[model samples]
Target: MTGAPTPVSPQQIPAAYQQALRLQNAGQLQQAAQIYAAILRTRPLAEPCFQLGLISARTGRRAEAATWFRRALEIKPRQIEIWTALIDVLDGPERAKAMAEAQRLGLIPSDKSAAAMRKALAELETGDPRKADRLYRKALEAGGDPVPLRETWARALFDRTETDAALKVLAEGLAKAPADPRLLLTRASLLETAGRIDEAEADLLAVLDARPYHPLAWLALMRARKQPPGAPHVATLEQRLPEAAADPEATRYMSFALAKALEDQKRDAEVFAHLDRANTMTRRKFPWNFEADHGFLRDAIAAWTPRTRGQSGAAPIFVTGLPRSGTTLVETILAAHPQVAAGGEAAVMTPLLHPAVEAWFSKGTDYDAQAIGQAYVAGMARKLGAASRDCRTTDKSISTYATMGYALDTLPDARFVVLERDRRDVGLSIYKNLFRDGTHRYSNDLTDIARQIRLFDAAVAAWRKRIPDAIHIVDYEALTADPEPHVRALLDFCGLPWDPACLTPERTERQVHTLSSVQVRQPINRGSVGAWKRFEGALQPLIAALDATRYDFG
Candidate 1:
C-alpha cells in the first residue's frame, strides 16, 4: 500500500513565488509574471500555472487561458476554481467534457440530476441567460432532480423579474417533490420574499413536519414569523439542540434558531448563551486568518498608485463595500435611472484583473489596461444584450471591493460608490442572516466578522487616500435620513442627468437577489439603523474588536 504524500512546508515554497504573489497583489503584474515564469522553469507548480491562466484570460486570450488552467488541473486535479476557469473558456463539447470531469471528481454536485442542474446554473454565471433558461428547461424535461433543479430554476426566473413565473415553477416542483425539505424551504423563502408571512410560515412548518430536526427549515420558520407569547417552538428547539450535538452543522443552525426564539421571549442571557454556542461551533468549522487578509490589503495599497492616464470612455459603475452594507441600495438606486441597467453582481472584474495584475508584477511589462477594461465592458454588454448598450450598467458584487484598485487602474473613467454602515450593525446583520452562499463564512463568527470589517475599512481608507477623486463614500444612515439629495449627488458623480425615478428606487422594476431585496423594495427608512442596540450587551466581543481598530462608524 502507498503511504500518504508528504505535505509541503512553508519553507519548501520558493521565495520567488511568494514575491510574485506580493507583486501581483500590489498590481505589478509584469514583474510578478516574470518571477512566476522563472519559478516555473525550476519547478512547475499548479499555483504559478494558475496565475499564468489568469493573465492569459485577462489579456483576452481565452484559448490560452483554458490551456494553462488544464495544465494546472493536471497537477492539482481537485482545484475547483481551475475547472470553473477552464469551463469559462471552452464551449460546446469541450465545456461539457470539462464539466463532466468536474462532476466525476466530485468538485461539483455528484448526483446526475444535481450535476445537470449545476451545469445549467453555470451557464447563468457565464452571462448567458437565454442559454441558462434553455438548459434549465431541458433539464426539467429530461427528469433532472426535481428539488435542486426547480429551486435553482425558480431563483433564476425570479432574478429575471418573472416573479409570477418563478412562483409557478416552485409550485410545480413542490407538487412533484411533495415532502422534500429543500423544495419546501425554497418555497417558504419565496413566500417570505413576497411578504406572504403566513403562507411562508406554513411552508416552513411543513418542512419541519417531514424532517423534525431540519436546521434550515427551523431557522426559516423562526425568521418567517414572529413567535407569540410563550412560543411552543422554544421548548422543541431546546430539546433538539442537545439531540443535534453530534452534528456540528445541525447544532450551529439549531443554536442560532433557538437564540432568535429565546430573544423573542426576552430571555437575554439565554439568547446570548445560544448565540455564543452557535457562533463558536460555526467559527470552528471555518476559521479566519486575519493576518493573511490584512497582508493582501497592504500589498494592494502599495501596488495601486497614481499613474499616467489610459484611454477613457463611458465606464460601468461599481457599487461595492462590506456585505450587509448599503451596496444593494446604491445599486438599486442607480439602476432605477433610465440611463442605467443593473448588472446584478456580475463577477467580470476580478477574473479580468487577476491575470493582468500577475503579469504586471512579474516584469513591469506595459499591459494594455484599456484593452482589459474594454474586454470587461464587452463581456457585460453581451450578458446584458443590446438593450443595455444605450445605458450605463452597475456591477454590485460586494467582493469586487478587493479589485477596486486594479479596476480603477484599468478602467480609468469607472466610478465607484463605496457604501458605509455602522460596523456593529453590519456585524449583527451578517450574523442574523443565513447567507445563501459560502463566500461569507466569516460572518458565522463575531470575531471573524469584526476582523473582516477592519480589513474592508483599511482597504477603503487606503483607496480614499490614493484615489479619492474616483470613489464616493455613501453613509447608510445619512442616505436613509434624506435620500433625494444623496441620490442626486450620486447620479451627478456618475455623470448621469437627474432623474426622479432614482428617488423612487422601490418602484424600479428589477429583480433584487440579495438579502436586502425585501428591504430595498420599500422607501428608505431608519428601521435597520442602530439595529445592533437591541443585542449590544451580547455583542461585547464584536464591539471590543471594532474598538481596537478605532474606525469611524460614520
Candidate 2:
C-alpha cells in the first residue's frame, strides 16, 4: 500500500455533491455512481452513501443497496429517507432490525416530501405549530419541484388561520405548476371555505378534466355543486364505486360521495350501506381507543379544580362541541358582529395545554396555568397575525371541549359556548360527513360515537358544575328555531352589545372552514333538526347506545 489514501477536504464536499446531483438528474447513473464511490473512498459521508444505495436499489442490486444504506445510517443515524429506503430493501431479521432502529431514531417511513409533511403534521398534532411552520418553510425554500411542498405548506398556514397567506401560497404554486391536480384540489377547498362556490366548482371541474377518475376530485365536485335530489351523477357515482374498489382510500372517497348522492335521492338504504362501508374502512385504518380517551378526559377533569384560577386577559370566546353540532352556526353568528372575528377551528388551545396535562397525569405536577395562558396567547397571535390582537374572536375548534378545564385554568376570563344537538342527529351527521382531518377516529363507529357523545355530556356537566358562570350551553334545535333571541343571549354572555347584523349570520362574508361551510351560508332553518329520524332503521346501533346511556333526544 502506498502509505495512505488521500482524503478529501470538507470544503470540496458541497461542489462535489452538486455535481453528483446533476449527473443523477441527467440520468447518468453510472457516472453518478462513480463520483459517489470516489467521494466514499475519501470520506464516509451519508449523502454519497445514500445516493449509492438509491442507485444500487434502482439498478436491481438490492443487497448492495442495503449495504450502502447501512453505511449511510452508521454515518448519519437520523436520515429518515435513508431509513425508509433501507426498510424497503430489507427483509427477515434485517428488516426488523432496521425498523427497530428507525423507531429508536424517531424516523417515520417516508420519502423527502412525505417525510417533511409527516414531521410537520406530527408537530402540529403535538401542539408545536411554530416548529411545524418553520419546517414547512424550510422545505419550500430548498425546492426543486414546488407543487407538493406548496400544497402542504399552504395547509399548515391555513390550519394556523393564515387564510389569505395560505391562498396566496396556493396561487403562487399554481402559477409555477399550472393545472397540477393536487394544487387545484386544495385551492378549490380553500375557495369553498371563502364562500366562493362558483370558483370552487370551476377548479374542481378542471381537476376532474385532468384526472377523471380521481376520487377526491369527484367528491369535492359533488360538494361544491351541491347537486339536488335525483341528479344524473348519482348513477355515474354508483358505477365508479366498483372501479375504485382496489384502492382503500379511493374507495372510501367514492363511497362517501355516492352516499351523499343517494341521500339526496331519498335512497336511505343505499346511503346507509355506503356510509357503513366507508366508516368501516376508515375505522380499520385508524382505530380509536375509547378507554384511553375516557381516561385522558378523567385525568384532565381531575387535574384542574374549581379553585384553579387562570391568568386573565380579554378572553377569546370558544365555540366548541361535537362535529356538526352548530359550532359553525354559532361562530358565523358571532363573527357577523362587528366586534367579533371568527377564527375558524384554530387548534391553539389543546396543543398549548398538552405538556402541562401530561405532566399532571404522569408526575402529579400541577399545571403551569400562567405559562399555558401565555403560550395560548402567543400561539393564537402567530396564527391570527393582526386578527389575534383585534376585537373579540371565537375559536370554533370543537375538540376543545375535551380540554375545557385546561383552557379555563389558563385563560380565566375566556368564555365557552358548548353546543348541544339531538344525539341521533349529531351521530348521523358525523357519520355522513367525510371529515378531512384525522382526529375524529370515533366518528366511523356507531358505538364509539355514542360513547364519545356520552363522555362529552359528562365532561360538559362537570365543567358546568365547576364553573357555571363561565360556560354557556346552546342547543342546536333551540338556536335554529329562534335564532334571534339565542344569538342575543350569546352576545350578552360574551359582553358584546346587541347588533342587528348578528341575526343574519348567513350573509356574513367571513370564511367558514368546516364541513358546514356550505350550510352556514344559508339562513338558519329546521330542515336538519330531526332529519335523523328518517333513517332510524339504519341507525339502530346509535339509537341503542344513546338509549343505554339515557340521553333524551325528546
Which candidate number would show the highest lDDT if scored against the true structure?
Answer: 2
The candidate that wins on TM-score is 2
**Cα-based lDDT for every prediction:** 0.75, 0.79
Q: Where is model 1 poorest over a 10-residue stretch in terms of lDDT?
A: 1-10
TM-score for predicted model 1 compared with the true structure: 0.69
Which parts of model 1 have CA positions greater than 4 angstroms off? 1-146, 164-169, 190-199, 225-239, 261-267, 306-314, 358-368, 382-389, 436-438, 550-554
Clashing pairs in 2: none
Q: What tens digits encode model 1's per-residue C-alpha lDDT throughout 294-367?
A: 65566555666555444477578999998888888889899888899998778777777766665565546556
TM-score of each: 0.69, 0.75
lDDT of 2: 0.79
Worst 10 residues of 2 by lDDT: 1-10
